[model samples]
Target: MEMERLDRRGLWMAVGAFVLWGVMPLYWHLLKAVPSLQIIAHRIVWSTLLVAGWLFWKYGRGWLRETLAHPRAAWMLALSGGLIAFNWGLYIWAVNAGHVVETSLGYFINPLLNVVLGVVVLKERLNRVQWTSVAIATGGVLWLTANYGSFPWIALSLAASFGAYGLIRKLVGVPPVRGLGVESLYLVLPALALLLWGETHGEGGFVAHGGVAAWGWIAGALLVFGGVLTALPLIGFADAVKRIPYSMVGVLQYIAPTLQLLCGVLVLGEAFDRDRAIGFGFIWLALALYAGDGLLRGRTAASAAAVDT
Candidate 1:
């Protein structure tokens, strides 16, 4: 019962996280005027400050000491931090550059990668149905890539970085918030330095000129809000991975890209004509196959356990 409830909580957390991620294109669109690198630097700097303050208050000093005492966790988060930073930079650039649809395609491809990684690294097994679903999904991604015009380096990079980050966070023995705080800390210095150089060179978006922000006060506020937006979903994601199977978490990720696809087509006015739609259709079919099979299997296992008891 306890484990069941934990899984239920994990399910909701994952859903919430994906939903937040799906709608994030709109948020990034608001900051399209800002340079992507500057935006990412602000994200790291502000997110670190926010998380650090929270940790300092809660743990009352020595928070860093506690986190770093675990060298393995620290090292893993350093790698994850760098990966997520790269992912964030690319994602924001893609959104602002009008590649929302292609960005969605990248995330659409991530779940299959996650499944393979889980099996290879964590020894998670997939049945015949799951393997079939994986093949279909792979076909969908290939179809999208071949049809989407230019090569999708942005999409592939985003997918790979986030997939690896998720796997590492899942394996690390640390609380979600604390782990995120530490990850932010790892990149905060470089992020600050980047912003400093940008401002000094007059290329930054957040600097104030004549007591007014270069891009207006609202944009500055939005830039700071980026930290909050980025951290919340990630924390929930970490918790979800801790409580549930990684493969299931990956399948559940379909929510994010689906929402992102809609945002790109409807809100952003991207060209999502028949060809793109057809490719997305194949991916959707695979999601349904994997998700339905998992649900059916879960019910069967629960019923069998009840009978045994």
Candidate 2:
């Protein structure tokens, strides 16, 4: 009973996290007037403060000290931090610049990219079905590119950067919250410098010549709340990952991009013509094939183990 309850909680947490992520474009749109880079800077600054405080409160100074003392871990986290920062900046810019649909496409393609990265970098092997799905997804992307008259660089960049970040985190074996806290710390100095430069050049958004009220105070409040928005989903995801099977988590991942696609097409009134529909259709079919193969393989493996036992 207890285990079942925990699993249920985990499912809800994971779903909530993905839902929040899916809706994030709406939040970023509210700060559309702010430069994406500046917004990312503030995100780094505020998230660092909040995460650092949480780390201190939860584990005392030992966790931070130990993490800093491990030179290799620190270096790996720094690299991952840079990748995530780049991803965040690009995603924010894309969402506010009317590339929300493209961004969704990138995330939809991310799991396949992760599988490719695993095969190439980690020497993992894929079955025939997995390879077929990857091929289909590739075709989908190619179709989109050919029809759109150019490469989908925005989507590709987002997928690659995030995939790389996930790879590094997996290799490093760092606890998610502490790792995020360290990553935030790694980013703080550069972010602060950028924010300072923006303010000096009259480009900052939270404040102006008059006061906080000039930005309606609501915007200022939202900018500050960006830290909470950044951290909360991560916390939920960490909790979910700990309590649920990774395959289930993988299945749940689609919720985010699906919601993002809906937001772009329905809420934001983005252009979604027949060409896009065809491209996305192919990708969706590819994902369905990929997921079905995974579940079938998992069941087979479990059955074999059961028979052996």
lDDT on C-alpha atoms for all candidate structures = 0.89, 0.80
Go through the candidates in order and give the C-alpha RMSD of each one to the true structure.
2.2, 3.8
Model 1, span 114-207: residue lDDT tens:
8888889989988999888889988988998898888889889989999999999989888898999999999999999998998887667766
Residue range 73-147, candidate 2, lDDT tens digits: 888999989998999999999999999998987876676666666677766677788678778877876777688
Q: How many residue pairs clash in each candidate?
A: 0, 0
Question: For model 2, what is the alpha-carbon lDDT of residue 158?
Answer: 88
TM-score attained by model 1: 0.93
lDDT of 2: 0.80
Per-residue error for 220 in candidate 1, Å, reads: 1.3
Model 2 steric clash pairs: none
Q: Name the 10 consecutive residues with the lowest summed lDDT in model 1.
A: 206-215
What's the lDDT for residue 220 in model 2? 67
Candidate 2's clash total is 0
Leading candidate by TM-score? 1
